[model samples]
Structures are given as structure tokens and as C-alpha cells.
Target: MNNIATPEQVTATALLLVGYAAVILFFVVRGALRIKSMADYAVGSVRFSPIAVGLSLAASMTSAATFIINPGFIALYGLSGMLSFGVVMPLASMISLVVFTKGFRKHGQTVKALTLAQWIGSRFQSTGLTRYFGWLSLLLITFIVLICVGLTQVLSNALNAPPLPVLVGIVVFIFGYMMFGGANSMVYTNTIQALLKLVVAVVLLTSGYEHFSQGVHGFLAKLAAIDPALTHATNPQSYLFRDYFEIIFCQIVIGVAIVCQPHLITKSLLLDNERDVNRYLLTAVLVLTVFFSVVFAGLYARLAFPGLQLNGQELKMDKIMSAYVVREFPVYVGLLVIMGLISAGISTLESLIQSLSSTITSDIIKPLLSPTVFSGTGGFRREIWLNRLVITVLGAVAIWLSYDQLLNAKLSVAIFAQNGVYAYFAAAFVPISFGIFLRDAPRLAVTVASVTALLVHFGVYYGRLTPYMQLPVRNPGVSAALGIVAAVVVGGVLYLALHRASVPEKTVAVAA
Candidate 1:
């Protein structure tokens, strides 16, 4: 394929990136000064405005998948993709976020939980369960790989550089600073990234306004001219958007559970006051609504690349957004959008690095070798350094996985990410739900539910038990939805059975 970026654009992007790195380093240094302990590192010592934390939540929640990769799906599949990604998914996630944040924050404050695993372990009073979640959190590395791939695609296309070196550079820079900054620097950086993304979202949405000169119908007519399937509510030709089940039901299920991720759910813990929760939710929901709409820009990209080819080479799904930005915009505007795309990836990448490293350090390693290995002031400092080491190891793993996906993706890295990430949240859905909602929830019930979710999700996907999985490219959403449903059923039954067994004891005590 031809280089989409002009020489001037490449030079400008390099300069823009250098300046971005300098700004990030300034914040990382500033935040590092306040990190005297792991608690400070995980939750931050600085008191931030509710609005800023809200913006951070928004930026963290809307990753490159929303801005870069999901748009590529929309570009390929059209309105069906939009309905699943832009409408149904966003609507469900926003509702779920609002519902879950308050209760989660209340409990998090009571237990002083740093990670999701800690929160679950503390709630159930089980050290073993905490360790289990710590190990299970490794599944999120797939998501880190997804973001790395997305950022590499954007940077490579904008800089007119090769993909391999670009991927390595991204992992090193982001994960390196993340080792020190943790939540302290992350909020400030995420807030800034969120604002830039808002502007870019508008620019991308309007970039194709000329396509609608004859009105909404005219835009659809244009898409229809390219391919009739593009204008359909469901694309029979596509793997993910074949019917309403995939477009609506499965998306709704996934969206509701998606917030269970460590980075997303634990964001509420950053709020120091209960009153801030309302304002935080309001800001996040409003900002996320706009960010999610950026997927509609895929429709714009489809119009730009009518044949999905640039200079005789067919565009990969992951590269579509990058190619669209470079081909459609002037150097200065394209550079700005490139920064926003990078910000989209970095905001979430930082959160994942902070939360995942913290989990491995505090929940996994510290618990395994506590009192014995981490007993004094020296051990405390050692834990902080150990967190950095975890980040370095994660960066190495991300580089390897991201490079493989860049070269040999089946369709999009989103599928691989969703498979792993979906199973995580699917398993987490029961434990977190029971922890937050039920006062006397049985740990065994939630544990069994979590295990069942993992079994069902992977079984349906690898076992090809469903028609959706039987396709050449299976839908992770199908497996995830089924897993969530099975978990709920199993957990609910066990919870009821346990409750009934305790009723006789309560009745006899009251009579005595």
C-alpha cells in the first residue's frame, strides 16, 4: 500500500508526539513526588475536582476501540455496526455505570480497597478468592494488546513509519511513565485527553457533512450505491451484525457487564466524597455519549473509501480509521486528530497498567509472600519497585502479542480482546453484583457462578456449541452473553438454596 501521510504531515506528527511526551512526563514527575505508599499510588493523595475525575472516567472508558477500531467495523458493516456499537452498547453501559458507581464507591471506601480483586476479597472475607481474582485479571492483557495494536496503527499511518517499531515505541513510552504516575498523574492526563477527544469527535463526525447535502436519505443512498448491505439494519454478510440478537440483545448484555473491568469499575474509588458521585456520573455519561457517537464516523469513512481500498491495497479493519484521517484531512487537522486517537489509546492504557500492576503487586505477590517478604519499611519500598517491574514485564508481553495481531489478525483485534475481556467481566459480573447488592451473599455461590461463567464463555466459543460460533469468524458477544446468563442462573439458585437452609435456624433462635 502507498503511504497515506504526506511528508509534511509526518514531520508535524513527530513534533506533536514529542511535545505530547514532554507534557506526560511533567505530570508523571509531579505525581511521583506524592507517592509515599501503595495506597497513594493506587488511589492518589491529591484531591481532584469531581468534574476532572468524571472526565478521567470518560476517557478511560472510551478506549481506541470506540474511536479507532470500532469505527473500522462500522465502516465495513455500516448502520448495523452503528446500531450495535453507537446506540445499544452506549445506552446500556451508561445506565450500568450510573447504577453501579454509587454502591461500589460506598463499599470501596469502607474497605479501603485498591483493586477490584481486593474489593471482592474484602467483601467476602476470603483471602483465597482475592488471589483467584488476581490471577484471573491477567485476562486483561488481551485488552492491553488491543489498545497497543490500535495505537500502533494510528501512529504508523500518521508518521509514515513501519508498524513494528511504532508498536514497540508505544508500549515502552506508555508503560514506562505508568510505572511511576499511577492514579496521581493518570487523572490529569486523562482529563486533558478527554477534552481533545471531544473536539476530534466533532471534527470526525462533521468531516463528511458534504455526503448529506441531499439530506439523511441522500447519505443512505450513497452507502446503498456502494453496497446495498451497508444500509441494512443487519448485515447478512458480516459475522458480528448478522441479526437483531447480535446487534441488540448481545450488545446490551455485553455493555451492562463491560463496566465490571478493574479500571472502569474502580474509577469511582477515586472520589473522596459521596456528594461527588452524582456530578461524576453526570459528567461521565454526557461525555461518553459524545465519545460513543464517534463510531458513526465509520459511515463517513465508508463514503470516503467506497471500495475500502487505498492506492490499490485493501485496508485492514484496524487501519481504516488511520487511513481515513490521513487521506481526508489537511496536515494540521490530521495531526490534531492523530493526537486525539493516541490519547484515546493512552488514557485507557494508563488505567490498565496502573490497576493491573497494582493487582499483581498487592493482591498476588504481596499476599503470597506477606509478613515474610514485605514486613518493614524496606519491604514497603520494595513493593513499589516491584510494581514497576510488573509494568516492564507487561510491556514486553504486550509488544509480543500486539506485533502478532498487527501482522495476522483474523479480521480485527477487537474479537481477540472481547473474547478474553468478556470472559473476565462475565465471571466478575456475579461476584461484583452479589457483593454490592446483597448484604449476606454466600461466597461459595458467587465463586461457583464466576467459575461457571468462564467455563460457559470459553466452552461456547472453542466448543462451537452455538451457530454464531460455528462461523469462520465467531462472535465473542454470543459467548459472553450466554456466559453471563448461565452465571446468573447458577448463582441465583445457589444463593436461594443457601438462604432457605438458614431460615430454620433463624426461626428456632427467635422462638428460644
Candidate 2:
């Protein structure tokens, strides 16, 4: 591929590219030689320490979306846009550390669960639905790949892609790296990438802080200059306010699923012990700090170019941060920013691919390998080889899908899937937590959780609050919040009912 980038930019990006490749390659070779069984392919023999689990968990999730776009959302909606993440993430971290970690270890089930759909089905005793979820999970994963391509475009646009062949080759290389090594290697790569993201974000923030002195104050002045209603964040007097809130939960659907996401779950499951959850908490804090710092750079751009507004029709707000950096920074610094986005993008892509592939094989494929005929160690080997094959095949499928629908699909679907990932786990999180702590919690409660979360998704998301009572309610978060309440209400009520029913044998004792 012919290099289109200025030599300085190319050298900077190339340095990052080579460094990341070396780390992942080492893991890939180590994993292949060491992995003789299917379990090895999926989970690292479930021997990962808390540090690895926490760091890996953090690395896997701090994807290009956060590195590239989420902070900008914070800038756009102020703190309101951050609500979905702000509300969900801390809860998610806790759930991973406290509630869900020990169960995988106790169940002695395979740890590297490939797809949440398959994992949930298997956990709930619905194996037949495995592939159905495999298909849905693939749908979601393809959405992620599209985001990867879109972000690649944004980055290359910043670098001013030298040519089409080079761009295509760049995408192919990132995909190929993950396909070769799978999740284990992706973990190592993500760790390195996550650190790089922090460094780049800090550098830009330190350099750019002077530009956005007014913060919210400056934002108000700019908003007033542009249009007076910017202060009324909640008022639907304008199209901008109306559309922003309307489409907010459109992102949440997948955000809810994020917790249940195969790759994210692997981070929690692969831990050595409960002690390491704190490390994940620390990682989460560090990542968000850097993320916000980067966004502030764009916010500063607002101060520098007070008239700056992301044009929805011709330009993507998603691409603005990169654009700002490229426009402002000299060649070398600009190169680092592009490389950071690429690294984050590649990390997210690899995790989704590896997790999806592993889930299909472990949850959907392995069980079928010997449905009525349970085999021993050799069976695991046969199934694992099948997993590697599944990885190759599905990775290819994702790439093809990316090439086809990758460009045309709404960035929101990918962003929504990326952001709203909390739903998947929310459906599963509370029920599982209750089951662990409360003696009276019934299995039916778990069922209620799954159903209510799904319904909540529709009701809050589609403006259908209740079958009988629909209002002009604007809270996009209401459905998920209420769904959680419904789960607890139903679960709690059922527990009391079951408890009361079991307590009334005093008179019967006398009769006996």
C-alpha cells in the first residue's frame, strides 16, 4: 500500500503499529503452543490473576468509542449525555467484581464465554436458542466492525489517507492480527493500547486546556451567540433537543447489553480471585479521566473557533475531535492522535471478534460436538480446534459484513450497541446477584428480570411507557430504570410469597 501520510505522521503511526504487533504476536505464539484443549482456546485455563482480569477487563472495554467519541458526547449534552454511562458503569464494575466473579469459578463452567446470548441461554437451560443468539450476537458484532471501519475513515481522514488501497490494507491488518491470536492476544494488545490512549489524551489535554477556559460558562456564551435555547437543556422547543433525547435510548439498548457482552464478561470471568476487582475500578477511573481530558481538547476548540458546530448533514460530530486535533496540532502530534484512535479501534474490533468466535464455539458449537456422547480430554481438543476454525470463518464473515453494510449503517447502531451494553448484563446482573445473596430468591425472579429488562427496553425506548398509560414522557432512561425496579419488585414480591407460603405449618404439626 502506498503511503499517503506525511513522512513524519507515517513514522509516528508506524512506531505505534509495530510496538503493538510485537506484544500481541508473542501472546499468539505462546497461546497456540500452549493451548491443546478447547477450554484453553476459550479461557486461559481460568488461571488469570485479579490484575490480569481487571486490566484485561478494562482494556477490552475502553474501546475506540470511548477513546474517539464518548467524551465529545459529554461536551455536547454537558453532563446529561453522560447519564447513561455515569449511571451504568460504576454499577457494572461492582457487579463484575463482587457479584459475578466467583460464580464462573464455582460453576467450573468454561470461563471465556464467547457470546452473552449463548451464555445466558446455557445458564438458563435453553440450549436450543444458542445459535439464535449466535446470529443476534453476530448482528451486534458486525455493527461493531462497522464502527471500526467508520472510525478508521475518521482517523485516515485526519491523516488524509494517501489512497484507497492503503486504507483497506490498514483495516485488513487490524482484523488479521486478532484473527490469528484471538482473545488472549487481544487482551495483551488492549492493555498496551489502553495505556497509549491515556498518554495521548493527557498530552493533548495539557496542551489544550488553555483554549477552553470558560467551560460551561463559555459553552453558554457560544450557545447564546448561536441560539438562545441552549440554556434550556430539557425544553423541546427546538429540533435539536427533540432529536437528541429521542435517539438517546436508541443507544441504551445495546448499552444495557454491554455488561452481558461476551468480551466484557471475559474480563470479569478470567480473574484469579475477588481481590482484583478493585484494580478494575482503578482502571475505569483512569480511563475516564483521560477520555474526559481528550474531549476537553475539542471543547477548547469551541473557544478557539466560537462558531464551531458539528453539521449533521454533511459532517459527523463523531469526526470533529479528530478534525480539531489534526487542524490544530503539528504533524507529529497529529500522527499520535490518529494512531491512538486506530489502536483503540483495533482493540475493540479484536475483542468483539474473539469473544463472538469463542462464544459460538464454546456455548453453541462445543456442546453439539458430542450431544449424546460425552467425551473426555480428547473431546475438548477436537472442540477447540473447531473453535479456531469458527474464529477464522466468523472473522471473515464479520469483515465481509463490514465491507457490505459497514459503510451505510447508522453510526448510532454501533454507538448504541457500544454504549448501551449495560442492558445485557442488567437483565442478568440483578437476578444473578440476588440469587447469590438471598436465600429466598427464586428462579422465577431471574426470569422476571430478563423479561422486564426486555420490556423496559421497548417501553422506554419506543415511547410506550405502559400499555394503558403512555405519556409524552421524555426520559429515555426511564424504561431501563423502571425495568430494574420491575425486576426487584417482582423478585422481591415472589420471594415474600414463597417465604410466607413455606412458613405456615404450625397447626399441621398438631394434627400429625
Judging by TM-score against the true structure, name the best candidate.
1
Where is model 1 more than 4 Å wrong at Cα?
Answer: none
lDDT of 1 by residue, 19-68 (tens): 99999999999999998889999999899989999999999999999999
Q: Alpha-carbon error at 427 in model 1, in Å? A: 0.3
Query: What would the per-residue lDDT of candidate 2 be over residues 193-282, giving only the tens digit for each residue?
Result: 677777787776776554347785775566466445434433344211234333344334334334555666545555555566567556
User: What are the TM-scores, per candidate, against the unseen true structure?
Assistant: 0.99, 0.75
Error of 1 at 232 (Å): 1.2
Cα lDDT for residue 411, model 2? 32
Q: Give the worst 10-residue stretch by lDDT in candidate 1.
A: 368-377
What is the Å distance of residue 392 in model 2 from its true position? 3.7
Count of backbone clashes, every candidate in sequence:
0, 20
* True-structure Cα RMSD, model 1: 0.9
Candidate 2 displacement at residue 93 in angstroms: 5.4
